[model samples]
Target: MAEKKIDKARRNFLFGAVRRFKNEDPDQIEASTAECVDLIKQANALYVDGDFEAARDAYRDCLKSDQNDADIRYRLGVCQYRVGKYRQAKLEFERTLRIDRTYQDAFLYLGLTLVRLGKPEKAPALWSQYFNIKAVVVQRELNLQIGLLENGESDPADTIAEAVEKAIEQAGSAVG
Candidate 1:
């Protein structure tokens, strides 16, 4: 008799929780959206100003609000890369990719981070993944920039065509 009473109470509690979850406060969601916009604006300003540490902190704050956002995770990874936190950057990029496998930039950045960590062999796979997701024209432009050393893996927004080139060269030598 006592066991049946406990089961009934547990079922009722679960149903109540589900009901509350399905009826979230709309105004609260609106306020969170506005706050997220403000945080993004602040983080973007800090990033554009070349204050990566501050931008990283701001991005982290944004993550607290939306932990599953792949773009925020990618931005945090870029900021970590800029600050020479290669391992942290690598982890963030990995997390970003896990959240959104089709995020081409995360693949590129993860490849670059691998090269920076002296794990060049891992980069080719990631670069290949990036190429698979990227457009041919964009790939050509990025390769051109990297060949010229203009954008060659310099920043998060930049290209990692050099890593791809190096990986190809390494493969050629191994085959030879």
Candidate 2:
């Protein structure tokens, strides 16, 4: 009974906030969303320009308005990654994939996040999924690694495919 009351209170508070937001001028809201998008774009550009903190702030503001936007979420994750916020980036990537399972970029970035988190086995699966969904660059990178292994340029167990699969298993706690 207490739990239900708490839930009801939470819902009421949320609905009140939404109502207040809705009561604002539509033009202002549209402008804000657009500005948020622009901020995200600017953040990406700034990241490319090597300004990580500014990018992070811009992405955060963008997310405040459109939290479910997968692209923005992924970009925010990437910015977090660039700033060495691996855990936060991992969460953002996970959220992005949850919002859009077919989001190849999110999968790829998730793999990269796992790598940063030092769980190598999981990284490879994400890399593989990314290869399958958007195969050109990732596939080429994997194939190149395979070729290197064939030539004995790298350890067999550390071949990109094996490495990725192992990373997945390790991340899943299947490995010690």
Candidate 3:
């Protein structure tokens, strides 16, 4: 009877410990997420303050914490670019795109990086791809807006086709 009581006590203790850990797991995860967001905000502030090296270091730290974050990789590449590290920036941008194939800004920056690396001819293809992606996204957004207007959820303004033409013109100017 004593042995049975002891065994039951041990089991109860173990179960209570496990329950406590399970309850705390979400708090730990939330703290980690908050820390990561703080790091990103700090890195962006450093970049905006013209401290490219510091921004790069912070971004590197963030990458160490989350290597799969394509946005951080892209920002790190921009910092590298601002610091005149074209080769490293190019690699970083490439990595960003590898992580997120639909990242349009990475495509633009990669094209610019190629231009800086004296490979102007290579930029055209990237630019073309960037424009194509932009066109698709813009078309999708315009279609949504048009649908909203048709359903009376949005006020009717200019036609969707006109908006698309204007967006294309803007995109062309931006590319040139």
Q: Which stretches of candidate 1 lie over 4 Å from their true place?
A: 1-31, 132-176
Candidates in order, TM-scores: namely 0.61, 0.59, 0.57
Q: Residues 1-176, candidate 1, lDDT per residue (tens digit)?
A: 11111233344455665657888543343113334767777887887677999999999997876677787889889889879999999999999989999888788778778867866545656666666322444455335434444334443322343544444334432210
For candidate 3, report its TM-score. 0.57
Q: What clash count goes with each model?
A: 0, 7, 0
The model with the greatest TM-score is 1
Clashing pairs in model 1? none
In angstroms, the error of model 1 at 86 is 0.4
Question: What's the TM for model 2?
Answer: 0.59
How well does candidate 3 score on lDDT at residue 126? 65
2 or 3, which is superior by lDDT? 3
Q: Candidate 1: lDDT of 55?
A: 91
